[model samples]
Target: MDGDLRGWRQCLLSGAVFAVCMAGTTLPTPLYGLYQEKFDFSELTVTVVYAVYAVGVIGVLLLAGNASDAVGRRPVLLWGLGAATASAVCFLFATTLGWLYVGRLLSGLSAGLFTGAATAYVMELAPHGGTSRATFLATAANMGGLGCGPLLAGVLAQYADWPLYLPFAVHLALVACSAAVLLRLPETVRERRPLRTVRPQRPGLPPRVRSVFGPAAAATFVGFALFGVFTSVSPSFLAHSLDVRNHAVSGLIVALAFFASTAGQLAVGRFGLGRSLPLGCAALLGGLALLAGALWWDLLPLVVLSALVGGIGHGLAFRGSLAVVAAASEANQRAAVISALFVVAYAGISVPVIGVGLLAGPMGLEGAGLVFIACMMLLVSTAGVYLLRRPAPAAETAGQP
Candidate 1:
């Protein structure tokens, strides 16, 4: 029908906007080293900067995660775009370490707002019975945009002039264009409310969801931790250890993990949740092992393999975790439960990375990475064994792809 076609078009357009906003979050990933050179900061400062973004994300998720449901998606998303624009501007004119932190925090706020609101918007814009494909579009847009961030920055930083300034400049333009597209798209929320109605949601789990939440949250944590490590520190490792100072190469290495995660997410429907969770765990374990090998032997091949394999594991486990948790929750409690999972995942991103940074001072990057890997490996293995013993219940029936 004509309506279906229109819905799909809108959905795609919204997804593009979503992607652009997310890309800005990672635009600075490849340029951290350049900032370090200019600012003369330590690696510990780098991880702290990265973790600050997670702090922003977590803060938003807890305080205003349901803002779109109250005030409508467009307003919240427009605010997200504004935050992203501020972030880009901060990066463009960054002179001190404080500027980078502020930029990263704003970037995180943009992502935190977009993550749930944009996803819900994309799905709502889809025609009836299009949930499955829309879910893929939203998730792909998320991870794909994240992948594009580093790649775009790295290429521009390597071959183009104004390495630090140009990327954010381009992102600012993209954000402006995205804002235009968003304005034209129809609002999905029918029940408009004042911002006063939006209440802060504390993370909570219903009794039913608690059983499945344990292993699922664990897998999600480890998966995100892997990503956290890759995005935050892998570039430094490549530059210092391998003497691979090419910005494009470092960006590509980080981007590969996110791209691979998107690919892995696409495969989950075929395997189903029951199988995917365990397989995801196994893959995560493999990724951690590959990273260990890369650290120990200083092998570039292993590093690449670790990104591919670990990315897949992250995708599989993350998606599967979402499905399993959704299946176990009562409908009214679903959003809060999902927020709890995200809290855990983002915590994984922040906590472990800061730990690595702390240890990096004494143990060196390689030793710190190995220690981090060893800890994540044990966690993933435990989750894997638990999933095998007790498969998640009713995921195929209740959860959407």
Candidate 2:
């Protein structure tokens, strides 16, 4: 039985659950500086710590990405929420740097569990003819929740007591409430089987979709890589170089990028998938330039501008990638192709960030950031050229909403 959930009520409830779980993944974003001070670690260590979360996400996606499809969405989701609560507990009691890594890994597990499962759950709960709106709800929940995590933590850390402890405590309360709300919602996955039966589905790409996948994936990789740098290292830059020690302000800057991305995703429907990809690439290049300028001149304003522009570009490219790849893919093969692209994207988030950290020690943070910008600029530019030369096939986007 499909959990009998229908109408807007169920849709919103599912979205709320998505938001809460996603928020937990980023709750520690603004607090990395505090962690660094307490642990007395290098920038490289900070990036490695952050990258560990992506590792957890990738691991879960590889291992149990389809668990909900097999065991039912509600059950898998309950387990995800449990993992998230445990992550918060880890953070609440974190007395050393090792706890942070463990907490991050657990948070990644929660996100990995929720990402595909929650997306499908929200979509399934929607009424007929509501796919576009449902897509918006899920996207917003994801980006909005990510943006909120740092903002909430920054505020509490700056103004309230227990900078390290309060944020996770608050998140714990929310996760508990979200779980309660979730239990009331209907399970959307029918014909469920035992979780043991689920296997790791190998990621695949159809030959026909290859051309479009190449350029689209390139864009996603750059966007995620840029975000990785910002979230992992920008706060330290602001505090050390710009003398902007306010945690709240640092969090706000990081939050702006995500909010801007949400806005960009919304605008993609107007641009059409074919145009959005190339346009997004161009915008991304411009953003990289702005970021480079920020690093070169050490201008805080430039950094802010870069976040806004880059985030918008990221939004456009990300949504465009989703549409183009989905349109190009055979209906049956869509999930695997999308999964492959995400693997590339998450690689962007982890690998290059660690590279930046490695370079940071020898080249310095600004120099390392400049190097990152240059490399990503080349990647995005190449993608832009490819997209321009070969626009999305008409057949692919013809059916796109």
Candidate 3:
């Protein structure tokens, strides 16, 4: 009983650290407009800054995706925390557009290191028979932490003084606390190897797994794309289109999607993975339609509903996809497979957002957003129809256990 208690405590601590690290990545969500005013740049520049983080994340995932497996989780996590702290410091002192790019890039590197390593670390810290609970811990820490970022920043920016500086300062303090918590936890990896053993991450999968990977990756991509647009550019849309310029309101609106996603993920276990994927895609399609309505009519309520409902779809599909792929992968290759899945997911978030930025100047925010929604809607609808026509194999369904 005592041992079990210790393990649970350790898992909780690890999850908290995971949340803190992930929060840094999105801490600037509500503050982008301020940067735009300060630096006098175009919307294209904003998306480019956001995309830079994705590039950093993809770069790390390709080069050192499995670094923690060799060097021990704690070492990699410590470095992630250190990077997060540095990122906060960058934001605190940011004066020009270049500083924003550097801060975002460092934030992405921190998230890249944390995503796989922290999830594995939380699971490893769990006691036997705790895998199911630990999975929730990992997912919640990831999505929940993301939700908190905008909320924290928005509230601080709205109510407190020094909107930009306070948020980063608070994040820096949270990083310090998380680092201290990590020091108290025991190291999970027993045979830690040198960094030289870490090889470049080449995408690898057996022929059998490819069938499930296709639809799963599609759903993950569309879901992340929705979130990407919401976090990066939706504030400008709300302000310029609907005339809602309140920073706290803007932050809360973006945060709503992430919070709804957490709720949606919880629903997946009750709904069953096989059924949830297509259902989620359908919800996503509806969300896209609602978003189009918002764009065309300039309806604030429609935008809010679209964010909430669409976020739920993203959560349901994302967690279902993770379970499906993880079930199909062998234990030895699971880490690599999961890393590949995230590469696809983050690409969804990064590429489409950049496209929106590029088109914003010519088409305007609403026009660019409508184009994005149309494309994502088509992609998600096709995936849903494919899943409905040919359901996931019985073998794959059974593999989920």
Candidate 4:
């Protein structure tokens, strides 16, 4: 009993650390307007700055995604915390657009490293038979931390004295404390390797895993596409179309989607993975519809509803996809396979967002969003149909080893 309590405590501590690192990524979400005012840039610049973080995440996932498996979780997470701190410091001292880009990229690197490592670390730290609860802890920390970022920043930026400076300073202090906490936690990996020995990761899939990977990756791509659009451009949409300019409200709206997603993820176990994927896709399709209505009519309530509903769909579909893929993958190849899954997910975040940015000038933000929704809707709907036609093979249904 004592050992079990100790293990749960460690897992919870790890989740907290993961949340702190992730919070830095979106800390600047609410402050983008402020940066624009100070630097005199366009909306395209904001999307580009946000997209840089995706690029950094994709780069890290491609190059060193398996570093934790090789060198141990604590060291990699410590490095992630360092990157996060650097990102915060960059935001604190930013006087140019370049600084924002640099900060976002570093933040992305921090997230890329933490995403897989921290997820695995949290699960591994759990006592035997506690996998289900640990999964929730890790995922809730991830999405909740992301939700908290804009909320924390928006509140601080809205009411606090140093709008930009205070948030990053707070995050920096949190990162330092996270580092200390991590130092005290026991290392999960038994055999650790030197950082130099970690080789560049190639994006590949073995023949055995390819069958399950296709549809799983597709669902993940669409889920993240939904999130990408919401996080990157929803605030601009809210401010311009609806004429709602409150930073706190905008942040909360975005946060609602992520929070709703946590709820959606929780439903996966109840619905079962096979059913959750298609059901999630159906919900996502509904969300896209709600988003379209909001865009067309310029209704604030519709937008909020779209965020909450769509976020739930995203959560359901994303966690279901992750579970499907993780369960199907071979023990030794799990990290690499998961990295490939994230590559698709991150692409959704980057490419569609840039497309929206490009089209914003010609078509306007509403039209661009509609176009994005239409495209993602088609993609997700197709995946849902496919999953329904042929459920994941029986071989792929087992949980991760």
Candidate 5:
């Protein structure tokens, strides 16, 4: 009983550590406007800076996605924390565009390392028969941590001292504390191999996985793209179009989306597997419509509504996609297929963001957003159609998983 108690406690503590690392990733979301003012840059540059983080995440995912499995979770997470610290330091000393770029890149590296390693650690630390609850904890901590970052930074930047420097400073302190907690915990991976033996999992789908991976990847892609645009440029839009200047307000609006997604993920338990993806796609189409309404009517309420509906759709689609993908594969091929899905998801995040940036210059931010919404609507609609025609095999056991 005591050992099981200890196991659960450690798992929660590890979730906290995971949360902290994720918080650092979005700490800059609300501050991008201030950076633009200080550096005198365009919306395109902001997108570039934001997209660079995705690049770093994808690069690491492709190259060392499974390093923790070989060298053990603690070492990989410790390195992740180190990268997060470096990112904070870069932001602290950021006097130039170059520093912003470096900070975002390092933040991405930290997240890329933490996403898989920390999740695995949290689950592994669970006591027997605790996987279900542990999965929820791992996911909630991730989204909650992300939501907290912008809220924290926004409040501080809006009302407190040194808007730019203080947030990163606070994050650095949190990172230091997280490192202490992590170091004191025992290593979860017992039979570790040397680091040199690790190789890139090189994402691929076997023939059996292709059918399931297709629509799942598409849904995942559109969902991530929605979030990427929201985080990367929506602040600028709020200030320019809605004339909403409160940093705290902007941050909260963005945070609402993430929080909504968390709620949506919890709601997935009520859905059967086949229904979740198709219904999720339907929800996504509705979200895209809300976004279109926001743009067409020039209404802030519509934007907020879009965030809520889209976030729910994102959560539902992502969880359903994961379950379906996991169910489709033989046990041996499951992990690699999931990694390939990550690659595609990350691609959706980075690539379209750049396109939006490129369009914002000529079409204007509002115009660019409309274009993005149009493109995503088509993609999501296609995915919805695909899922309705042929649900993934895992759909039958989704809620159970």
Candidate 6:
């Protein structure tokens, strides 16, 4: 009993650490408007800046996704925290557009490292027979932390003294505390190798995983694309279209999707993985439709609904996607396969967002959003139908090691 309690405690502590690191990644979400005003940049510049973080994340996932498995979780996480600290510092002292780009890139690197390593670390810390709960905690901490980022930054930026500087300052302090907490936690990987042995993880999947990976990756892409739009441009849309310039309101609106995603992740166990994937796709389609309505009608309530619905869809699809992929892969191939999925997911965040920014120049934000939604709706619908016809074989037994 004592051991189990200790295990749970460690797992929760690890979750807290995970939360802190991720929160830094999104701390700049609400403040992008302020940066634009100070820097005199366009919306296209904002998307490019936001997308740079995804570029960094994808680069890390491709190059060093499995680093923790080799050198141990603590070292990789500590390095991630270091990167996060650098990102915060960059933001704190950002006077030039170049600084924001660098900060986002480092922030991406921090997230890329933490995503795989921290998820694995949290699950490993749990006692036996606690995998399901651990998975929930791991994912919940991830989404919850992401949600807090915008909220924290928006609130601080609104009421605090330094709108641009203070949020990153607070995040720096949080990162330092997280580093200290991480140092006290035990390393979970027992057979650690030297850092020199770590090689870049090329994206590859077994033949059997392809069938499951396809629709799952598609859902993941659309889900993340939805998030990319919300985080990157929703604030701008709210400010320009609705004339809702309150930073706290903008941040809370953006945070809603992530919070809803956490809630959606919690429903996966009840829905079952097989059902969750298709259902998630269905929900995503509905969310996209809601977003279209929000864009077309310029309704504030519609935007809020879109965030809630879309966030739930993202959570359900992403968690279900991760579990399905994990269950289908061999133990030796699990990390690589998961990394590949994230690469695709992060690509969704970057590529499509840049596309929206480009179109935002010609078509306007609402027009560009509708076009993006139309395309995503079509893609997600196709994926949904495919899943309904042929669900992943591993879904029923997912989360079992």
lDDT of each: 0.93, 0.88, 0.89, 0.87, 0.89, 0.92
- lDDT for model 3, please: 0.89
TM-score, candidate number 6: 0.96
Pairs in clash, predicted candidate 2: none
What TM-score would every model get versus the actual structure? 0.98, 0.96, 0.96, 0.95, 0.98, 0.96
**RMSD per model, one decimal:** 1.3, 2.3, 1.6, 1.9, 1.2, 1.6
In angstroms, give how far residue 129 of model 3 lies from its true place. Answer: 1.4
Off by over 4 Å in 2: 1-6, 394-401
* Tens-digit lDDT string for candidate 2 (103-174): 989999999999999988888888887887999999999988888888889999999999999999999999
The list of candidate 5 runs beyond 4 A from truth reads 397-401
Write the residue-wise lDDT of candidate 6 on 1-401 in tens digits: 99999999999999999999999998999888899999999889999999999999999989888899999999999999999999999989887999999999999999999998999999999999998799889988899999999999999989989899888889889989998999999999999999999899887799989999999999999999999999999999999998989999999998999999999999887787767888899999989999999889889999999999999999899989988999999998987898789889999998899999999989999999999999999999999999888867898777333
- Which consecutive 10 residues in model 6 have the weakest lDDT in total? 392-401
For model 2, give the 10-residue run with minimal summed lDDT. 392-401
Q: Model 2: how far is 118 from its true place, Å?
A: 0.9
- Residue by residue across 141-188, what tens digits does model 5's lDDT show? 888888888888889999998999999999999999999999988998
By lDDT, who's the top model here? 1
Candidate 6 Cα misplacement greater than 4 A, ranges: 396-401
* Candidate 5, pairs of clashing residues: none
User: lDDT tens digits, residues 101-174, model 3?
Assistant: 99989999998899889999999999999998998899899988998898889889989999989999999999
lDDT of 4 by residue, 1-401 (tens): 99999999999999999999888888888788788899998878888999899998999888888899989999899999999999998999998899999999999999999998999999999999999899999999999999999989888887879998999999999999999999999999999888888888876687887877887777788778888888888888877778878888988988898899999999887787767777888888899999999999989988889888888888888887777777777788876787788889899888888889898989998989899889988888888888888788732364223
- lDDT score at residue 304, model 5, on the 0-100 scale: 92
